[model samples]
Target: MTSFSPGRLGLRAKFAVIAVAALLLGGVAVGYTLRSTPEPSTGPAVTSDGPERRTTGPGGPRLMVLSNGVRSSVALRDPAGPREVSSQRCERVYAAADTVACLAPAGALEGPKLLVSDRHARARESVRLTGIPNRLRVSASGRMVSWTVFVGGDSYAGSSFSTRTGILDTEGGLRLDTLEDFRITREGKPYRAADANYWGVTFAADDNRFYATLSTDGHRYLVEGDLAARTVRTLADNVECPSLSPDGDRIAFKQAVDGDPAKGWRPAVLDLATLETSRLAEHRSMDDQPVWLDDRTIAYALQRPDGVNDVWSVPADGSGAARLLVPQANSPAPVA
Candidate 1:
């Protein structure tokens, strides 16, 4: 009788191989059942390092970007939604109902100007702001808004463009105060401005004090200016892009150590009293603006290597990692 070729398996061998495969698959299933980790417990509320300390509007807030210095924010019923808000071109601050601030050109700029807009990019007020007024700040009540109108066409702006910070009442009255050598606040604590290049003007929760970034002789610092006092004091050093907390106790800013605008920088937090500086996040890319969410978390605009700017958020306490809040964004503002 001819012998069976080695290439063909006998019935017994085939059965053995099948039996081994069955046993192996069964063992894998059993091992997976025994060794797999249990699913994490879900609860009514989850906590984290940052805003567990302050009152937050909604958990897992979503971001919306508009332009270089503008954004719109809305509630996140679901984080995975299409990022569609009920309104068109609203500012990012969502805490107050229908309250958001947009940065627009002040007017037909004979010189530099800042235009303040409502949540929907509608005109709120024009401050005749001159010089390079980049970032504008509005009060918690959204009543008062201010910004630095740098005057220097050249470098002498510290002396020449040294601006007179102005305040406007939506009801009617408009007042523009001269520089520090001469301030124009009738009362309210005697406020003074840092310098001409100083931008990022923001009002306090009480609508009393204002905060901003001042570039003096190329060194960047944070200043808390008292409108009533008519005086300005440097709060923190090596920092710019200052955004105050909703409560008005802490400040979120980007620190520039090299003192050169070309070198780039990182995001930081500073205690208003001690003037102590702490780094919240580092960026190989440019981090443009930061807005506070409940005084503990900061949301800002960041640009990646591919040149797509997006919104991002990280804890103020520096306990958590930097998370991308919006995948596509330019200037991100936190609402309410």
Candidate 2:
């Protein structure tokens, strides 16, 4: 894997690097391009007139999303209605419990950073990091936060891309800068590899146990990790961007079409105990991580050909059709 130093690259060089990487990665450009240009409002106009901007608290269920680049929220019951927009800008964001995690937009001469904030959107902590932001997640209890970034390549389907995934304990201040430092067990034996790349982490309710995608050699596997033990063991193959369901009995993940990344990915659900996989009804290729809106439904961002995104939801049991939940929004994080 090649190393990338974002701080050392100029703005033009950075874009050039990404453009070239995208072409080499089978013409699937980085997901950021889909969000670069702002699109027309699809529903009611967003407003900042509301006092319930906080992600979590004594309010009705709301869904946190990125309206263009700014942090915003919409009522879960009426997603097409007006929204409360915030001043904070993030490349990727997620909220759970009383905590919110944001991947601050990267600058030409600066690397991306992790910004931790409270439910009220107050900045609490910031950690400097490298690479372009790709994925971010906050544990259900809001105590653990994890993120993934692209260090070299752009798309997950390409072999040239290098990734760095990290975890931070908000309460204890324990940080794992890279999952590479943790021990890995593959096929019931000690595993070690220079090509190992971990990403798309989803934590269990306990926060001690987690699941993430481990790509090595040429295969992608879903691995169950123990935060306390600092170890991970392979559970299944061809699972990427695993998002644990609210009930914790299953995981919503993107599975490569026919076990091939060049073909794209399909949203699927895996029963943890039975290890059975059920493919969802949505046939379109979804590159974003699927977040569970509840135990019975899953939400994810789908990008159109012209660089526009909309949040879509599908039944977790593979029974219902996919429907647009929020238009002109990305990074759907349900906050109750």
Candidate 3:
């Protein structure tokens, strides 16, 4: 295991990054071309130990998974006077409606533990995970919670990039650790492989149906998963990190460039009914699964020129230019 710094490196250093495992937003492999343009300064300074302030926004309540190296806190999105929901150190956080799920890794070398908490960050139910949890999401109705973790390996090792994507039925007390048991079909035929790994889950409003990224035998594909039948089938190739839209008819995902996973991906949206995909105007490698700000706009985290991660938004239909939404925020959960 080697150390990874998110700063820009020369060609020699980038080649080194490919060898040693690099951590992306969802704990996926990092192999994208760096964006050289400087991001415009818009919000307040991102301080790890800053005090809470109150600022107004359009949505109901803005949720941010913030950490100051030693401690992680869930704070409201107000930059002027942010409000604290909890003082727990979480690696990732997802909030929707009245449900907030926090992914916390127990020590420096321990596995992850997930806590389903209230809006005030009170733990209502908790569960231990089999791996290091990275991505967290809640269904539109807040009845379903899904998470993805790098299973059986550490983030620093090349072999540890394999993932286990899981879903928890909060109302039913049902938990599926991995989708490997789900019946799988590739190109409309039964495809079985022991190397299949799933990650980056995005759920629909119905809660029973969802989409995710499945990797097997050196290839990645966008998969449609059904909760009731416990089955999944590949929908398309070269798709990683599928995020369904607010209307449940479209999906925003990352498309691998030039059929190469290591070359990085472009953010795009797919109309589920039409099977049509349109690339957004971000024009940079996005490592995080995007969150829908509304039906028309989507937000995602990108490493700025200052090396810290910030939230940015673009039109879902690939029409408008990208704009900075929140500064120094890694995980953006817009509560409505």
List, residue by residue over 1-336, the lDDT tens digit for candidate 1.
979975788899988999999999999998996564221111122222211111333545544445323233334433222333222222222222233444344445364444455555455554444444444455667666554444554322123444334554443454443424434222234344354345566677766677765555445557667766755666556666678777677788776546555567678788877777777765554445578766678877776777666667788877778876655555555453
Q: Deviation in angstroms for 132 in model 3?
A: 2.6
RMSD of each: 17.0, 14.7, 16.3
What shift in Å separates residue 113 of candidate 2 from its native position after superposition?
1.2
Regions of candidate 2 where Cα sits further than 4 Å from its true position: 1-40, 44-59
Q: Clashing pairs in model 3?
A: 52-82, 53-80, 53-81, 53-82, 54-81
| Leading candidate by lDDT | 2
The lDDT of model 3 is 0.72
Clashes of each: 26, 0, 5
- After aligning candidate 3 to the native by TM-score, how far in Å is the CA of 118 from where it should be? 1.4
Q: Estimate each model's TM-score.
A: 0.62, 0.85, 0.76
lDDT of 1 at 221: 54
Error of 3 at 40 (Å): 19
Residue-by-residue lDDT tens digits, candidate 2, 220-317 = 99999999999999999999999999889999999999899989999999999999999998999999999999999999999999998999999999
Candidate 3 lDDT tens digits, 1-336? 988666756889778777665434324422221232122233322222222222333334554544332122223344323333234566777777778787886777766788887665456778888877778899987878989887666431133377887789988989887788998888899889988888889987788999998888767788998889988898888788888888888889877778675667789999888888999999887878888878898888887677787778899989989987655666777764
